[model samples]
Target: MELDTPVLDDHMHLDPDHGRGIDAVEDFAHLGGTHLLVVNKPSWHLGVEAGDPDAVDPAAAGEEFREVFERTIKVVEAASDVLDGRAWPVLGVHPGLISRLVDERGFSPEDARDVMQAGIEVAAEYVADGEALALKSGRPHYEVSEAVWDASNEVMRRAFECGAEIGCAVQLHAEASEDMSEVAEWAEEAGLPAERVVKHYASGRLAGPIPSVMSEKERLRVAAESGEPFLMETDFVDDPDRPGAVLGPKTVPRRVRWLLEEGYEDAVRRAHVETPQSVYGIDTEATLSE
Candidate 1:
């Protein structure tokens, strides 16, 4: 284990060829990858990846999520031997996927599009302006943003409530400080703690070869000072299909070093180890340096 210079690839999607087996995780861990947060799509959380494996559109509408949790349990258990208290799992629904689930489950007011055309019968009742819109007919956004946020909060709350519920760390995809601030706002409003939440999708504007403005970078500085436990992801993907993965092994270390140079050691350490180890149930006491 690379305990001395550990890096946590906090968020990883399952690539059919590159990410399916425990061996890959073991090797990554042996190569200084101390922590990995395996991400799985759940039906209830629909903003990023769909979690339901059986839903009509598993990637969109989302299906039963408990099964995904079950699958996660198995994956974590299977990887336990190789990880030996190093690897961990963080579980939560993506924003898009969760929105879809919230709408379908009658937990939040549906968009007009969610209503079925006339004469169409569908499961789940839709309540709009105190009126029940059958699965077919169109309705309006009697939606209170608060209501929707609360509903999502409840869903995540249940995920956290279960003792087995993996924090896997909470994340959002936003770039600017305003947008990223909104991510924190939503997380708090949804009952997610600031400490366990991580901002992994600081993609697009927040990172790239060309630098984003220093002002925009200040969001991270503020987040660091808020005394809230938040982390950042370099968002590196190691799939064979990715050019960077094929080109260089420099992305991970470079980003960590950059964060260090920025005087964001809190963010750096959290992104690399603390947040992930805490969230994914990994043994943090062990050094992860190779």
Candidate 2:
């Protein structure tokens, strides 16, 4: 599928072994993308999480991240040489992995988070001066129980403190639900302007008790009350029969346009995939060769 504007996948899965190569990504980005906010999530955990069944190409992408970041460094460094620094070399640990690493790798959750935070901090300062670090959160278990919630929040906060420009996804697979107050607390602690920290993927609903994130009025209300930030996104998955699944981009943008028709200005901004790319320090306009 083709889109006139950059279609941002707020939560993307580009693995080391099976991702589009650097050249391919650059070519795609040059097509119209301000830049792809390349989140280094590896292969997918299939048959576990259910995705859309209507996409043209269902890409079950995600699994482990040990190599994602390692490969990311290589790609980001290569961007300067290959794409003339147009690559959005993002650096942030996936929020969900906080517990996974602890349970599987046997490290104290706090320590694991600290190391993750350390990488984000170092990457922000050393790699591209805090411009490129896509500080993200919205870990699935965030609102479920305090144990992982606290850990996820701490990780986000640490990344925030490091001056990383923070953003979070409004994911579907969660046991804890999103309460505006709780979300507000997380946003406040992270010092993320409500707009800057987008709650994306409105396509899927939170699995826990809650219903919708914020009502149309409530979304505006949250922005007004907190004077923080707000935005919307269609977290399109690569389901084979889905319109925007995989390499295709649709449905999500229409929903965002609907938000605009209904008076969600921030929602429009969220639709611009380039905003995060710019906020996170990816040079979208850099000249590249085909």
Candidate 1 versus the native: TM-score?
0.49
Per TM-score, the best of the predicted structures is 2
- Local accuracy of candidate 2 as per-residue lDDT tens digits, 48-146: 221123323222212223344556656655543443224454555556655555655565555555555554454444334434445444455444456
Off by over 4 Å in 2: 1-9, 22-34, 42-70, 73-87, 126-133, 142-145, 164-181, 189-191, 203-270, 273-290
What are the per-residue Cα lDDT tens digits for candidate 1 across 1-290?
A: 12345565544543323443565556554544454455543322222222333334322332333344445445655554555344444443443433454455432323211211100111111111111111110111234366555444443333323211222234433233323444344444545444444445433232111111121245446545554444443343445546344212223444445556776676656544554455433444473421
Q: Give the TM-score of candidate 2.
A: 0.53
TM-score of each: 0.49, 0.53
Q: Residue 49 in candidate 2 has what lDDT? A: 24
Q: Would you list the C-alpha lDDT of every candidate in the order shown?
A: 0.38, 0.42
